[model samples]
Target chain A: MGPITENHLPRGLKLLLILAACRGPEPQIPIDPTRSLTLQTDWKFTSPFSGLFYDYYRNENLIFSGDLRTNLILRVFNHAGDSQYDIPLKAVLDTLEDINSCALFAPDSLFVMEVHSPRYAIVDKQGRVCRVSSLAHALCPEPGNRYEVSGYSNGIASNGRSLFMSAAWWGDCDNTGWDPSISRFQYIQRYHLEGARKCRIAKIKLDPDGSKVHFGGCNILPHLTDVPRFSYSGMERVLLNGKLFLFSPVAPYILQLDTGTLNVVHRIPIDFLNGPAAFFPPPITEENLQNGGDLVSKPSIAGLAYDTSSGYYVVAVLHEVPIDTPEGENHLDRPWSLIVLDQTFTKVAEHIIPGKLYRPNHLLSTTAGVYVHRNIPGRAGVVGPKTFHRIILP
Target chain B: MMRKVIIWSVFAVSCVPGSQDARLSRYLQEQIGLTERQFPKAIVVVSEDGCPHCDRAFADLVRPRTSLRDCLFLIRIDGTTVDLHGFMVETQNVRFDDDRSFKKLAS
Candidate 1:
């Protein structure tokens, strides 16, 4: 065979070469089944409001409270469910309104997104403010920018140096308020930790007819039925090793984005079992709600996490139950499940949570199992510590 | 006598919402059994489906004046856990949108 040259390469060989050149660095971490640990916390987070974000960092569970109504604080607890420290964030951020969500990254840093403004703050583990930066400048740099950043950011992820957030920029702003239907752009933005803006990496398409399927809302005004109350059109993301994985609420596949160029590398399809009807929630309408429909959301990917030990991607799904079904009484009663996908993006095991005893929004993928919150915080009639149940695949 | 006159004057002026949302005004009149004279100047709606912090922010902004006759707090009760953190009380100004009438009207 002649020495392979760029022009003389076969079609398959050329394609492989191009793919190899474009592919980002993939980190291979050993998965140890024995390293999996079951976690439960005794901290009773009975705050009257809901807006806390949870994550596992360095074998310790971190809970950040950013509800506008409550005192902003970061509560750290050990694996034994004992409180280590509760650091107040209101003073740290010097803002009374509060943050929407937070991402805890390497070297013990927290990237917090604000609820009332287009800004973010970096703070240390001790609740000391490291730097405060403007996302408006990074995102909407155009003069007299029409795209207004919504008050709430859905999810955040960081790869130590760059902070990423699922943010929405709406151009339809008027006296009425910001409209989600006419949202100009939805992006997973990347910003430098020091305050410099990076690239507007991923642009997520807004589903025009998604209002009925996705619980839609405008950030400014409340009490309008046509407007609803919550509208977050961003993807949940996880930055593992060197690759970025994104799970959109409306998309059926998880996208792997190249970290440096911010381009889509691979699309991992999620095969939701149709027979069991697990992790699949059918869409409903306003008429259904008027006719005693209990839930308004379609099946959505609530969160995504990666288990370095097992090389499994755990996707948390919220299932929408029919109104006639008994489980449709409350959102918390709706079924949720953890779908485990192997390194090759093949479905391994799907565990449907047996009862309506846990919150589907919170989940941590571990070697032992996926740890999920037992109950939603601030829920009425729920008492005791914030507990988590491990879902071991059968 | 002076205090009573001032109180009456305030009530008369604040009987109607200064800038009422047309749909909400209609909803209050048609669904909630509220007369035109009973119209509130401001309305705060709370639901579990929405941002909890926004709801609390609204509640905190209106807590000092929650007893005002011109302000109304509508708590959606159906298919939601409407917790106002003790800010809601049994008063004429506060009522549950139990049947989701406002929800239906708004949607």
Candidate 2:
């Protein structure tokens, strides 16, 4: 047979090649939210991080749930979704007042931070309080920074000697009223385990000057008042490979910082298909406040998790849906996209998840798969035995 | 006798809407500084426990209509003590149910 050159190829084959060359990159596979591996637990699953969105740590095959005050049962599950152990945390629950953030500082101990005060405790796996201390006197005041340790602790993690937490900061830190003129900022501060402020690592401005419309309080303001979904301002923290990485839903980059130097070493850019969505909520005017309606909702990066086994990163992109669609009205019911990136941060696969079946928030990634909250159609936050659906990535 | 009393109490609470509504109205009026003349035709209850987006949408829907402003009383159930100073400045009849009396009535 003669060499099959371009001219020698059939007409139909030539046309097919031309069409294939003109076509864009391959489309993402549409993932059916219902078609997933389910994790049935004996106890009802309540989010451990009270009001804040959180991700739990996965050590080897075991996944440890957060130890915040809102946790009903401190659960430890294997990669196979079977419960290894569950602690009620009754012994230490009473002692830790309004626990907001929890981190495993030691192999068998949990470092917990409070919501109402600058107090923290070290509790063991057996729910026994090892030590308690308050940070009110320890934190040295910054000249311009009105650092409020209580309530503003967004992302908290411990590296044995120090604890790091992000604070959603605005004017005065009281969060009494909304001022559009002043720019909002997110301050990540490092502190000694004993509650003393070590250094301010990073301070990134949250919103463009006067961009947001309303500020109800510190809690409501960070998440945006009247906009019910998770805010782009909320920072997600991960302690990987002896380095701390901070990622905000809104920011396009994951900040890798060295705890010892307190310097942001690397700014790893998240290469999404078409960058992160541009979020702009409708201006909450005085007239709207007085009289009542113009609010615009936007899509956001719901959650981010790193897989220990595969050295891959899985991010949940909460895509915006039409307001008229009944199922898409709530933030939890919105359509989602699962983006899988390799160790080099290259996009490996993308899955388009339809709304109303699953919530991509509070993602727990492991060797087996990424675990997401399986929601019943119509009803929101219904308690049941089976907690999450495991989505095994490609 | 105790069981009978419990059943009767449950019946009184569940079945008696006329007295309960009136008491609730009076209680709400007093709590929110509502006048007898300014009776609300619609009452929008926004709870922190409910979907935040839906609550915000409801607030947005009712805000633009001047007719709804006079007839509607927007009651918000906050998790913590809400500073009503900002709420009072608005022309809309917005009230924070701090005492959780509304939650009690619903329960």
Candidate 3:
């Protein structure tokens, strides 16, 4: 064939090149045929804590079930569906207070953070506590009196032997009570698998006017609200392209932070396909409250998973309006939905699970399948012990 | 036996037409200050077997919210706490632990 000229090129090819130049480089997402496999069983148990979400970590021999309540990591066989194993998580000295977030260094070594206690623990698979570090230790270089630790570690992610943790420091340093200003100074710390702090990244201080602080290397920018109402949760590291994809539930935004400088490389705004304001629950009127109905807004993006095959991010989002119910009164009525997004985090397709499936607490992808834990009544807290449904998505 | 009869009597009285629903509405209103208009279109009342308070709470306190009849009425028997799963299934005419489906009871 003769050399093609610009004049002979199709109209679409020219348009694509012009757009690509402006947008710069993006991750390539592959398209694959869809398939799903469901595991049967609705294991139920009441949680000592309030939330019913848990993390599922598996190795060749065992699958460890960790909850946000107790430090106990229930161990079961990899193939044991709906059956409890004989071995329980080994006990450590420092209680795994807030089992909300956990990172496994290997099959045996793990890091657990207590979001409420603001404490960190490195424990072996046998459950022996290797090291316990408190936020007070970092804040006070010289301590005349030891500060009480809160053990509330919201997010935990690992990079080989080193673990990264997000800490929320609440209460006044002196009184140790809830102080709005005190919470603004949240920190992201890197530690050895044994729980020793290597380096810490402090949150950018907000201006007096409450404007965002623009620090160069911080993943959470200064402009972001640090008030208790706006703190993030469930920070996990996605090791792809030598970059860490951090998922924060507070600003409820996903941030891509550079591991070296600890600076945010990109911020992907996450919201329901319908605008954020549009999905928010209607204001709670006296009528709704009295009727025991709560006007609850669906979360824009709650649980996120990376699909390696498609190079797309699959997020578990609240697709329906949460039923209006009294606070503390559980409403097991809403349907959970999942949305698949391309590299830019723009939604690709929305998948609403067909029936009432209670509340979904966590979403994780494994070689075996895509596991999602549903919050069943009497189930363990946010990191509930029960494995409600295992959806082997194709 | 006598205590059981008394408990059974209370349960029976609580289930009398609209008594359960009325008492529940009143209790919610009094404690949480919920008005009849503010009641949910559906409410799942969870209880265990042999607990007189839970029975009374459901029958007398929860059943009266007919104003919110649009709201669903579900009785979730605690299989962990009681053996009422079979009894609940038969009486409520629903499946036992069908987490896949939520059937609305016919008025």
Alpha-carbon shift of residue A170 in model 1 (angstroms):
3.5
Candidate 2 lDDT, A213-266, residue by residue in tens: 111112212323333232323355655545666665444556666665546676
What would the per-residue lDDT of candidate 3 be over residues B1-107, giving only the tens digit for each residue?
53454355446434536755666566446643457676543344434445544454444443344234334344444433322322233222121323212222211
| iRMS, model 1 (angstroms) | 8.5
Task: Provide per-model DockQ scores.
Answer: 0.03, 0.03, 0.07
Positional deviation of residue A9's Cα in model 1 after best superposition, in angstroms: 86
| Model 1, span B5-67: residue lDDT tens | 335434543464434356667777876668889886656654555555444444455556666
lDDT of 2 by residue, B3-98 (tens): 443344345444648867777677657766677777665554444454434443444444344345544444452221111222322344665553
Per-residue alpha-carbon lDDT of model 1 for A1-394, expressed as tens digits? 8886888878899999899999986532122233333222222332212122334345433433232223355555444344556555665547424556565554356655666565556677777886766544334434322233332323455444554444444432232253455532221111111111112233221222220111111121111113221222344566654567766554566778776555667777765545221222122333433332232444566666666556777777767556454323445556666678787878888766543666566655433345666654332323234555654443
Report the TM-score of chain B alone for all candidates: 0.55, 0.52, 0.27
Clashing pairs in 1: A31-A309, A225-B106, A358-A374
Which candidate, 2 or 3, would have the higher DockQ against the true structure? 3
Model 2 chain B: lowest-lDDT 10 consecutive positions: B77-86
lDDT of 3: 0.41
Write down the lDDT that model 2 would get.
0.49
Better candidate number, 1 or 2, judged by lDDT: 2
| Model 3 ranges off by over 4 Å | A1-63, A67-73, A76-87, A93-102, A113-115, A118-120, A130-135, A139-155, A171-243, A247-252, A277-296, A320-333, A358-360, A374-394, B1-107
lDDT of 2 at A50: 20
Better of 1 and 3 by TM-score: 1
Worst 10 residues of 1 chain A by lDDT: A187-196
